[model samples]
Target: MSKETMPAAEAQSYELAFHVLPTVAEGEVAEVFQTLKDLITKAGGELGVEEAPARFELAYEIVKHLEGRNRKFSSAYFGWVRFTVDPAKVEHLDEEIGGNKSILRHLIIKLTKVEEENPYFFHQAMAEQGKSETIDLDEEEAEATTATDEDASESETDSEVTEDKE
Candidate 1:
């Protein structure tokens, strides 16, 4: 009898992106990240880029009441985190996030071939198109050029009339 080894089971990984309510104070960054990382790892995936681990900009002025309350309790900041996880574990991860208020919002989208297109690449392509369009004279320039041509033709007609009279 020929011996054969069974094919190894394939585990698909999924990329996840989500937001955190606030940042960790002082040296507590590790604690916060670890807590999140541990949760994700337990769910069966590895954490990826935690973009802008700290607040970069505010969408709007923190309302006075919110600010006061936040200060009274603790400073609240907005953050974003990305990670790669097993497809099966993603459900658990989502459930956990849904159960936590600290996570303001989260989205888990399947990355298909079409969705995997780089947004930056699209942006660059659009920018190049914009540059080309900018190089070409716009509608206003075309109109101005046409007006000047008409004015020159009118001046020529006036000169022809004077010459004919003379």
Candidate 2:
């Protein structure tokens, strides 16, 4: 993510997204994120929302560090971070992210502004699954209501028959 230009203003914000190889265990995941946060702060950047690391398949086979420390990875734990920092330090931040061996890929896009509604990277599919499960409750309620209505109608018919018998 080493862009050629960064303005001098200190108020600039950015989104730093990256993928870590799945070979790394969950316990070690925190350390990698902490390293990135330290890098951003040291380079005069403010850390913002952090996207939780999630497992996803890669678009293409990435032979990471193949020339020297060769390895093949088909999937990774993807994460993203929002941060604000001085424009001058963007290059250094890019270098830091690239140099990290644990990081398989990284992208740093300078954001014009930060908004809450923008499509943030997260595990939306999981939430959607949970939502779909909730629909069962609504279906159950409808069935219960139908059963109560049937009971009420039967009770009314029985009373009418009793009155006719009397």
Query: Which candidate number maximizes lDDT?
Result: 2
- Indicate the TM-score of model 1: 0.44
Cα displacement (Å) at residue 103, model 2: 0.4
Worst 10 residues of 1 by lDDT: 1-10
In angstroms, how far off is 74's CA in candidate 1?
14
lDDT of 2 by residue, 74-166 (tens): 899888888888877788779888998789999998665445337464667656776787444445566533434434544666455443443
Q: Which tens-of-lDDT digit does each residue in 1-166 have in candidate 1? A: 1111223333443444444455445455445546666787787776554543343234333432233464222234334454555455666677876565454445665544454443223334545786787554344576543434434544656555443442
